[model samples]
Target: MTYCVGMKLDKGLVLMSDTRTNSGVDNISVFRKMFTWQVPGERIITLMTAGNLATTQAVISQLEERTKEPDERDNILLKTPTMFQVATEIGNLMRNIIGERQEANGVKGRGRFTASIIVAGQIKGMEPRLFMVYPEGNFIEASLDTPFFQIGETKYGRPIIIRGYDKQMSLEDGVKLLMVSFDSTLKANLSVGLPIDVQVIGRDEYEASHEHRISHDDSYFSAISAGWGDALKNAFHSLPDYSFYRGDD
Candidate 1:
């Protein structure tokens, strides 16, 4: 299990994914869930995956290979003229991989090889876009009203995003929001342990403007965790008392 979140903002895009995988409590391991592709000033793309590690890695490896091969093969990086097309290609690949695994496992297959991804990027002339691709090869885009998406162990952290997100928030504030979201998920779910990989792509810059591996010892993330918790508690206590309840008492 893992947690991956992507936000579409007025200024640009922000993405984060954890590096935890587990077969059981004793079989836990760390594997990065984020991947990126860039053509410097022309385009930049980032992917965060969740679900079966093997399937996700295979999908990423296949995309990377297409960009390197002289012979053109249909791939997210090559055949897609736009970010929308790139997402379609990725979705199709995910569905194909899932079907192949199910067939190989025969009657005992639990459909366990499924995976999902969040895709976001900017092309030379277009606005930055964000998408959540599901295991079924279909996806939904993030809009102004619904400005963010998450996969895997998402429920624990979703509330913070819902309450705090704004389309105009700066990249700095966006990163802070994601850090709080991850902190909440980490505290509540053992399956979503951390060492988070984060990347920020600013609009029209066509390269990753900021990227980092945030471990437990990272000072800024530690501060974010502590600060958000204290802020929430103070906010709760500062709220006015219920007058109806007071009269009843």
Candidate 2:
């Protein structure tokens, strides 16, 4: 399992995904969940995956292959005319991969070969966009009402993003918000973990403004984790106490 978030902001787009994948407590592993395609000043596309590792890797490898052989008709990640089209092409690719695996595995593959992706980026002349692509090949774009998208082991950290996200927040704040959300998930679940991958795209820049990884020993993330725990405890203590008796208020 994993946790990945793609957020749409007034400044542009911010994305982060954890690297942990595990079949059981004894079989934990870390593999990068984020993949990016950039054409310098013309466009930049980022994708994060969660689900069956094989399926996700297949999807990415196919994409990489297309980029290498740009003459290939299906080379759309870089060739797609719009961010929306990019989402469509990716959804189709994932759906096809799952379908193929399921057909090959028969009953055994009923639910085994599935995955979801969060894709975010911009094309030079078009507006920056963010999308969540599902195994079914359908997707939803982020907007004012739902300004962010999360996939995989999402429950533990979602509320944090809901409470802190602001469409106009700066990329710096967005990163902080993701750090807190990821820290919360790490503490609650072993399936989602450290060495997170993050990317920030500034509006109209047609490229990534910031991209980096948060390692296990990153001092800033450590501070945020400790600080949040203390703040939560203080907030809980400061809340008005309830009384067992009716007159105690």
Q: Give the best candidate by TM-score.
A: 2
List candidate 1 stretches off by more than 4 Å: 66-79, 107-110, 242-249
Q: Taking the tens digit of each residue's C-alpha lDDT, what string does model 2 give over 59-166? A: 998877744656654545888899898899899999999999898878344488989999999999889999999899999999899999999999989898999999
> Candidate 2 overall Cα lDDT vs. reference?
0.90
Q: What are the Cα lDDT values of the candidates?
A: 0.89, 0.90
Q: Could you estimate the TM-score for every candidate?
A: 0.92, 0.93
lDDT score of residue 159 within candidate 2: 92
For candidate 1, write residues 59-173 as lDDT tens digits.
8878866456657554458436899998998999888888888888872434888889999999999999999998889999999888999999999999999999988899989
RMSD to the native, candidate 2? 2.3
After superposition, the stretches of candidate 2 with alpha carbons farther than 4 Å from their true spots are: 66-75, 108-110, 247-249
lDDT of candidate 1 at residue 35, scale 0 to 100: 87
Candidate 2, after superposition: displacement of residue 45 in Å? 0.4
Cα error, residue 89 of model 2, in Å, equals 0.6
